[model samples]
Target: MTEQIPVQPVRQVHLLLVDDHPLVRDGLRARLETIASIRIAGEAGTAEEALAIAASAPVDLILMDINLGTGNGISLTARFKTEYPHIAVIMLSMHEKTEYVNQSIQAGARAYVLKDAPAVEIIEAIDTVIAGGTYFSSGLNRQTASSDAGQLLTQREQSILKCIATGKSNKHIARELGLSVRTVETHRLNIKRKLNIEGQADLIRYALSNVIV
Candidate 1:
């Protein structure tokens, strides 16, 4: 005699799609819906709407676009991480610039994927992030490897470089980051030395060329 056992259903990973474009969200929903282990919990067109939805009904992962019309997705990612540290975030952007990728990671995004990437890559990113790992688009990794800039700068140095690129003074960066002016200056010097940048003009040029707008 043989005993029959009931099969248990696999749990689905609930996801929130945040993009300013309706078409983009719809396309993502269509692709993600095909995966048996993934579910679309909600869709938001702005950071505010996303936050509101998440506050009411939490999701396991968030697929967020970098540009959200009037809002910035990177800042939103930081906010989400600050408020809900458990949930993972994967950034979707058109830019493959190393600075953008690094900044997104610093902002608490578990993965940085390009919008034009194949659906399989996106799915792979989702799987990796859900499995407590980080992922970056293949193209982005290639670009980062070619430049060698991302490897040279620490996270704090990257932040300082971004500030410098945006025309912020040392005093402003110090105040904003809660660091002393001397500390900011030291970081600036270290950044220049690491990048082999000689002067303020060269530093700004390097920062402008490397950083994403």
Candidate 2:
């Protein structure tokens, strides 16, 4: 006599897609569905919708766009990590700027993939993030490495420099970035020390010349 055993199906990785574009979402859904162990748990065209779906459903990961209509994904990622620390997030963006990548990482994204990246790279990012690893697209890594500004400045410093380059006052930069004016002044002082700029004019000139947009 022989006993028969049933084999259990492998558990799929449930994912949430958050992007403002319906076509992008549809294309992502089709591509992700081809993978055997990945499943789309939900789709959201805005931050509000994404938050609502996450509260109701069991999502293992979120593939979020950098720009979600009027809402930004970097801020949303920080909120999600603060509220639901267990869920992982992978940022999908067209922007390959090191400042954006650094900000996303600081906000708790497990991976960053460019929108134009091949499907295989995106899949690799998903798998790596799911396995509790950090992943950045090869192009982004190369850009980060080749840019001396990226290597020198912290994310906040880069942001402040950008504001300065745009002729924003310390108070304005502080208000826009949600920091106190004193803190902005301190950052400016630090930036000057690091970059060896002796005066306001020099700082602004350096910022305008060095800051990436």
Candidate 3:
């Protein structure tokens, strides 16, 4: 009598979806569910929720967007890396800007992809990141000469950035840096113009990622 050999079960990639938009999550789930080797383990609309779910669930990869309300995706990615470094993260963002991409990378994301990219590319990014490789969307790997890379600042500006990362106000940073309020305001404006940070949150993310001080 001939004995039959048992086939080994292929491991499915467990994924956590983080996006504020319900449609986006549904669309992604539909597309990804079609792949036999992928499984949607969880979903989150905010970074805090994502972190909590990640802590409780078995996730192999996180498909995260960079614009989650309250907790931005970059900051969440950084926190996740700090708290749970074993899981891989692939940032699914509409941001094609060099600074945003740089921030995501600095925050420990394994991949970055624009939202408009083909579904196959997104899937490929997840696969690549899970395999211990880095991935970037096309035309996003290099910092251009006109890029935010040239956003230079003085020593004081660097110090102020460190302050900002700690959630300090202009007046508070001024007091800490031993500068006048007006001078601190000027430095803040310079930092904004130089770093191309559009909002206070962006400033914080940029500072946290740069950590020049």
Best by TM-score: 1
lDDT for residue 144 in candidate 3, whole number 0-100? 25
Which is better, 1 or 3, measured by lDDT?
Answer: 1
Clashes in each model (backbone N, CA, C under 3 Å)?
A: 0, 0, 0
**Lowest lDDT block of 10, candidate 2:** 142-151
RMSD of 1: 11.4
lDDT of the candidates, in the order given? 0.84, 0.84, 0.78
- Flag regions of model 2 displaced more than 4 Å: 1-6, 145-213
Q: What is the C-alpha RMSD of each candidate to the true structure, in Å?
A: 11.4, 12.7, 13.9
CA shift of 164, model 3, Å: 38
Residue 103 local lDDT, model 1: 75
The per-residue C-alpha lDDT of model 2 at residue 155 equals: 88
Q: For model 1, how does the per-residue alpha-carbon lDDT over 1-213 read when each residue is reduced to its tens digit?
A: 899899899789989999999999999999999889998989999999999988998599999999999899999999999998888999999987767776787788878788999999999989978876566776565445226666656789889988998999999999999999999998887665444455899788878888985
Candidate 3 lDDT, tens digit per residue, 35-123?
Answer: 88898998899987888888788888899999887669999999889998988889898887777777776788877788888998888
What TM-score do all the candidates reach, one by one? 0.68, 0.66, 0.65
